[model samples]
Target: MNKISIGQSELMASQISLGIMRMNALSVEEAKTVIETAISEGIDHFDHADIYGKGASETIFGQAFKKLGISRDSVILQTKTGIVPGIMYDFSKEHIIQSVEESLTRLQTDYVDTLLLHRPDALIEPEEVAEAFDELEKSGKVRTFGVSNHNPLQIELLKKFVNQPLIINQLQLSLTHTPMIDAGLNVNRTEAGSVLHEGQLIDYSRINDMTIQPWSPFQSGNGKKGLFFDHPDYLELNKVVNEMAKEKGVAREAIAIAWLLRHPAKMQPIVGTMNPDRIKAITKTTEISLSREEWYKLYLSGGKMLP
Candidate 1:
């Protein structure tokens, strides 16, 4: 795997991050296999969230991670907070502090290299978030802070008080779910105003040097059902992906992953698969390069062009 600097920081992280959200259902032995497989493939960056599997995933990892007993410094432990049972958001100082403590307890770690606010809280108090982060940083509980699914303005709003740099933003990205990638596809039209987050998240992160970790890189949902891997509407795009994969002698899925990392922004595509072979395949994007024409061909086939 290739290393990319996370955000503006000098810390180098693997381009492909591993998500352990689904391991809650896997047996301890099974979880170890999946995690160990990732380690074998040089995937030391693991993503976690507090509410995943109702906290069962963290517990499972705590056990497996402890058993493996890799020194805490060897891995980059990143997680998120703020989505709870009520479908509401919470950036309350108490919740943030408590959440990190619980996550550390569950993940068997002393501190998280990065903690992301899961989503924007409509009523967020920048000061309260600041307060929580201040303490977390001072106590060495959280080394860095960022947000997930947040836009540019929201992050700027937090910066008014958040003393530490919020240097990362978790985004939902896939070959088919390319709003961030496609927002600028049409510049002369007024419709660009209607795009979610206004593409500012991508532009802002790039200019500000924030790392973007994309979840669900291979979901078959962007066309008939919704990003462009398996849905019926993307048959043509799929054909192109297959053709490119055959030409490059790599898996189509690997081609899909390469398309994202090839962007100048240096996005880190986080995969949710527990499959070892798949993890090995996707991370190989760090080596493959796509031609500009091949990249745009898939995007155009995903949508109507000149129609």
Candidate 2:
């Protein structure tokens, strides 16, 4: 597994992340086996969310780790908060503080390696969030800070109040679902479809030295959403992926991940498979580097290329 440095932090993370959102459904022993397998494959970072199954995911992880007696220092746990069900967004100092306390208890850990704001809070007061993060860091509750599904301006807004360094921004990215990349390239004033990203988030992240964590890297960018496995719009792309997989002697997933890793932006794909075998096989994606032309062809194929 290729390692990427987390800003100035001592933590070095693998290029791929194991997302434990579905671990709540798995038994403690089963969950432990999956995480153990991931760690064995040099996957130390685990992505979590407080609202996943209403905290069941964190509870399952906590119970499994406690039973297995895995040391806290060996792993880096990252979880997000600020998404309140029925209610919109939340970044209030009280909410951030309460959420971290709850997350720590559910995860059965003294501190999370990274804490990301799940989504942007419309009424976000940077001061409140900054204060919460400052206290969390000082209290040894959270080691680093980051955000998810946020654009460049939102991050800028948070910067005004946040004294701590925000080094990671997780977003939805795939060869198929890529407005962030395509919008800037396909410039047409008359076409409404040309408006992509509405913000230059990818470039902003790279410029600021923030880690770009791409989730749902295989989703089909078509009429249907989140259906990347054998998706119709993804046929050509999957074909290329399968072909490359055979050439590289790795699984098809490796090809999909490579498509993202091959980018100049150096994206870290957040892998969500619970299967240990899949985890080990997908890490090979980082090993295979697709050529520049191959990456572009796949990107153009995802869209009806304009003349």
Candidate 3:
């Protein structure tokens, strides 16, 4: 797997990261295999959230990771906070500090490589967040800070007060779910794709040097729509993906991941699959690069119209 410098920071991470959101369902042994497989495949970055499996995922990963006896510095661990599940999104100083303390305990680590504010808090006070970040940085609880699911202005708002550079913005992006890309490509058009839902985040992120961590790299769209592979709405997409996979002699998942990696944005996609076999297959994305035309073909095949 290729490595890229995350934002303007010194944190060099793998091009593809493994999301441990589903690791809670796996036993310690199973989780150990998954983590070991990912590490063997050069995936040194692991993404987690405090809300994932109600924190069970982190606990399992910690136990499994400890059992592996690998050096803590060998792999980068990134996790998110600010989401209280059904309650509300809280970026309060107390909540933010408490979340990290709890996450550190669950992860069985002294500090996280990166910590992201899981979601935008509508009631966010940038001052409180800044204070929390200052403390976290000074105390060595978090190495760096970023946000998830935030638009450019939201990031700007945080940037105004937060002293640290917001180095990353994790968002939902895949072949079929590309509002950020669509809004850019369909500029000035009357189509629904022209709607700027994310305030031109792709451009903003690049200009600001914020790495965009694309999550749900296989989902059809937001919510319970499911994966695009073999989905009824993505028959054409599956055809193109399958044909490309056949030509490249790689799994269809690799093609999907390659499409994201092909972008100049240098996106680090978070593959959420826990299957060791699938993890190995997905890592093949680093072995192949899609041509410009092939990349567009996939975009079109995913049911997008290029203006």
Candidate 4:
């Protein structure tokens, strides 16, 4: 596995991370197998969210991790907080502090390598967030801070008050879901692809030296439908991906992930597959490098047109 420095921090992690969102559905033994498989493939970073499986995922992961007997410092654990399910998004100092405390208890750890605000709270108060971060940092509960699904201005709003450098901004990016990349490529065009939905976050992250963590790397960009691997709308994309996989002697999943790694942004894709075989296959991404021509071919095949 290839290691990339997260943001400006000294923390170095695998270019691809395993997301434990669905770990709640697995028994302790099964979860252990999934985690062990990932670690064996050189994946040292694990991503989690407080809202995942209603905290059950974290509990299971904690149990499995303890059974493995691995040193805490050997792996990086990151979790997101602030979503209250059906209630509302909360960024209050009380919620932020309390959330991490609860997460620590469930994760079986005294501190997390990183903590992220799950999603942008419409009623976010920068001062409150800053206070929460200050207390967490001083107490050694969270080593680093970041945000997920936040736009450039939203990140700037938090940076205005939060003292810690927001080292990461996790976003959804895939070959089929290319709004961020499309906007940049279609600049000044009258086409729908010219609409800048994310405020050009790809450029913003690179300019600010913040790492962009791409989540849902294989999604079809359509809700609840499933991965793009065999999605009907993505037949062209599937063809290109399969051809590349055959040429490179890798699994189709690696070609999809390799497309993300081909970007200069150096995004760390969070792969959420729980299958041990899939985990092994996906890790093969590190061995293959997508050329510029091949990268564009895959992109164009994903129902995108270049001006």
Structure candidate 1, residue pairs in collision = 176-227, 221-226, 221-227, 222-226, 222-227, 223-226
What does candidate 1's lDDT look like per residue over 1-307, in tens digits? 8878898665778888898889898988888888888888888898999998888898898788878767778788888999886878999999999999999999887899999999899989999999999999999999988989998888999999999988889988777676776565545565743355445567778888898888877765444353456667778878888888888888888998888877888888888887778877776766789888877787677663521
Q: Candidate 1: misplaced stretches above 4 Å?
A: 191-199, 220-227, 304-307
On residues 1-307, what C-alpha lDDT tens digit does candidate 4 reach at each position? 9999999798999999999999999999999999999999999999998889999999999999999999999999999999999999999999999999989999999999999999899999999999999999999999999999999999999999999999999999999888999999999989998998999999999999889999999988846378998888888999999989999999999999999999999999999999999999999999999899999999999988989
Q: What's the TM for model 3?
A: 0.99
Over the stretch 1-307, how does candidate 3's per-residue lDDT look in tens digits?
Answer: 8999999799999999999999999999999999999999999999999999999999999999999999999999999999988889999999999999999999999999899999899999999999999999999989999999999899989999999989999999999999999999998999999999999999999999999999999998745488999999889999999999999999999999999999999999999999999999999999999999999999999888888
Q: Write model 2 residue lDDT over 79-136, tens digit each, in one string.
A: 9999998878888989888998999999998899999999988888898899999999
Candidate models: Cα lDDT each: 0.82, 0.84, 0.95, 0.94
Cand. 3 Cα-lDDT: 0.95
Error of 2 at 195 (Å): 1.4
- Candidate 4, residue 266: Cα displacement in angstroms equals 0.6
Candidate 1 TM-score to native: 0.94
Score residue 193 of candidate 1 by CA lDDT: 32
Query: lDDT (0-100) at residue 258 of candidate 4?
Result: 97
TM-score of each: 0.94, 0.94, 0.99, 0.99
Q: Which of candidates 3 and 4 is the stronger one according to lDDT?
A: 3
Which residue runs of candidate 2 sit more than 4 Å off their true CA positions? 188-193, 304-307
